[model samples]
Target: MLAGIGLLAAVTVGLTGCAGSGGSAPAASGGISEAKAKTATSAADFGGMKGLVASANAEGHLNVITLPPTWANYAKIIAGFKKKYPKIAITSANPNGSSADEVAAAKSLKGQSTAPDVFDIGTAVLNQNLGLFAPYKVSNWADIPADFKDPAGKWYYDYTGLMSIGYDSSKVSTPPTSFADLLGPSYKGKVAIKGDPTQANEAASAVYLAALQSGGSADNIQPGIDFFSKLKKAGNFLSVLPTQATVNSGQTPVVLQWSYNNLAFGAAGGSAGNPNWKTVILPGSALGSYYNQAINVDAPHPAAARLWQEYIYTPEVQNLYLAAGAYPATLAAMQKNKTVNEATLKTVGEPPANFVQLTADQATKAGTLLSAKWRAAIAG
Candidate 1:
């Protein structure tokens, strides 16, 4: 749940494309093959087949639009890409607004004159606007996990964050350990959530976590609603969404947030002396949601977009994200990235010892049921 500056910066920079393999075999999930990786690595020698980078530079520069304004690390990532393709210039335009704003921009890009070369969007937006993407499977596409990419190769997830609970130690001695703990008397009137289930990603995370805790499947979300209803009855649920400032100031003691956001807050204000904050990934819960990147269907600089994507998914960049408390999607990169210290991994809430990946269809169905159930629970 890292918020604002650090989280967005890490996500933006860390979300580069997958790396090319020299001789490594392709993963079953449709990642980059060894041969393609070598070709991409030697992109400068590709001659007339200059790929997206050449095309983008020919157009003067590559244009990118993103939703996360706090993505301060964009410059660093862009700099890295520039080192490889010096001729390609990157122009970034971040329209600060909701997912709806990104969707609007995607639609706007359909027009030849107004189109951007790349886009970064939330999971919901990516799935909803699959049409805006051009499905040119990257050379490293085989390396990416199937669950992380679109079936049609439209969009792919680079990093992920778990929806977790944050607690202010000054306000309470024992933080909630499990989902049931949130319903306890000590936490009554102390909890704050992000959004209504139907409106926000964080709200959807809450539902997903509740469903997991209650043993509900994608088709059954009653457990999630029941969990929320219990909290509502106890008058424990604070309906307002907690912000970075509010959490850092200790104004709201307990918040359901992304692990990255919580970690960022803790890094800023959490210490041994005051020890103001702490975050915990509730057991028996799924990773709440993800943010994704995609190349525009008619990108003016397709090669640049591909290169950018590759850079974002590399071990070095992924580690940068891990440093900021977000989880990288590439297992190889995660294993190779030395910057991802053990402490940071613990804070970011790595997958459980025995984790199960969810299918897109399953996630969609689960989200739908959970939304309905959450509404009923909140109402009741």
Candidate 2:
């Protein structure tokens, strides 16, 4: 549940699922393996690659939701998945949808082909929808920290990024380096957050970072809310969510978002597709957190859903997450194996030494407060 935890992401079977033959196996009743599919909690549950691959390819596609290519270098991850498993077609929906939106999609799209087969969301949202996740443990399950994963293998923490300020160097003469700089007269009508704090994990993290800077702790978030309310009163806060288009057009000259988000936008955003944007650090506040990944419990393509999770934890893919400024969940294991990409580390550097991380209880408490107070605090 820490800030940068981008709660975010394969198999083969030798034979066609029972759905195809219906001889002795009816696709194992919602699973592609000869074993019951719905009861599969991990890749081991499947008999072998022959069944998993064939069953997954038989299902044909993976429906993932809310995976913006810019966030944590997901474009590469998706591309890699397809390359590794050429048969499974991967489809992404709602690139701009939030953690809350993902849970809603899983529940609301229960029996549909469109249900997100996999998810990358914050721990707060993950907690609300635990029962909806199909319990799954990756091949490298031992590599993940105990505290970061669910005991039942339902969901696990994936990566972490810090909250940061993204700026267009050409527009602002003096780029704000501190949280206080955002409230200055020059920033009026120029600064924006990724989304509404009550609904978006990134936006809510921004509020938490502001609280840290505004004489508050995880126990008290009012100060952060007050800081934004002040920005609203000064006309400095624009509700429009920051996007590559918005950033390039100067609509949102400054964006308060995750460091990975800011860096990704800077590297690939703009009219010419260049890294013209810059990310700045605020004094003494690194809102570091990890996001969670889960599989839809009732996913139509259960085999494909499980495959996606396995692929994401691989060393190469985990490194892809790092190249895009995210700290992958298997980082510690990678370091031990001497597979930690030093070059990638230099791009993002070590996270701030002075950082604030909310405990499970603190985050749960904070979520309640944010949901109840965010609207009134920003209203006219």
Candidate 3:
């Protein structure tokens, strides 16, 4: 039987400001001190997180470790979770600089006292560390398509985002329609891409997209390397991927990034206040990947973690992620809800007209091979 631990409440203070407004100082009644009133205001400024406080009280406590330097607007998700489960205390930690850092964290949690209850990992990492996870088939498991989850329930994808090219409309009159176009003379030095596929999702995505373009399966990434080789030869490859702020600031005209990143950037207002930054889906590309969530095998608060899982999979939470430009993992959830804005929806291309979905086994095999071949091809 799962033993319930003593409830301990701790708040993970986010960068976002506190939730409520403060009232004016009360008039002193019978010589009450002004300092007390000032203290009251300060308390109001940083006093209570009712949601987090309540969650900690009711569901024990939760510790969620994730890839750090946080994503844009992730605070909203954390705040939303607290609102729904105020009794579940959440503590977030980031040890290593990149997603690779999570590996060390997972190892530390093994049969030890300091393991995280929840983990947000990349697909590649998920493939490598399935043993670290505790399999709890989520209540909404049936709703998720077979392609997006682990059959034994070790880990499940919460959301999927495609990697694509974002082009500045002002500089490039015609967007490149396919991978071949990226190698053309006109596009030389016009593309900025994040390098180091071994350590970066964006770089891995570039390899995946290239494989599709070159008739390579996700399991076979040689095509991706060959594709990049040509781009490198053309001198069109930019050293680093552009950030949302950089893209919005118009520092780079063309960038390879996740679709959600492009959507979020455009919604926040693009270059020159035009909101015209656009992402195009490359035809025949195996470029989509998922950001997955898993429960640690030694979760300190399993019940609370499960509750968090249920909450995130709900239509409400799924839609919230969608509104923020993430693609919901459940097709039924997406169809039943209408939270993604029209302008944002318009920019998201339909899955390539004749695309094929990769099975878990296939994706793992392909990702591994592709990583190896990409290194060789790029070095050539």
Top model number, lDDT = 2
How accurate locally is residue 71 in candidate 3, as Cα lDDT from 0 to 100?
Answer: 43
Question: RMSD for each model, in Å, please?
Answer: 8.9, 6.6, 13.1
Tens-place lDDT per residue, model 1, 1-380, is 22232322222232232221111112212223223422333234333234434443444455666533223234345556667667555555543334445567667655443456677666654666677776645555666788788777678886666677878888878878788888889888888876666545556666667767778754565686788888889888887667656776666788886666565555433331124667776655445466677877655444555566767777666655565555666754445544445554554445555333334666566556655566667764
> C-alpha displacement of 358 in model 2, angstroms?
2.1
C-alpha TM-score for every candidate: 0.70, 0.89, 0.71
lDDT (Cα) of model 2: 0.76
Cα TM-score of candidate 3: 0.71
Compared with the true structure, all predictions reach lDDT values of 0.58, 0.76, 0.57
Which stretches of candidate 1 lie above 4 Å from their native place? 1-51, 58-101, 108-117, 122-125, 268-275, 285-290, 298-304, 333-350, 370-376
Best by TM-score: 2
Residue 63 miss distance in model 2 (angstroms):
0.6
Candidates ranked by lDDT:
2, 1, 3
lDDT for 170 in candidate 1 is 83
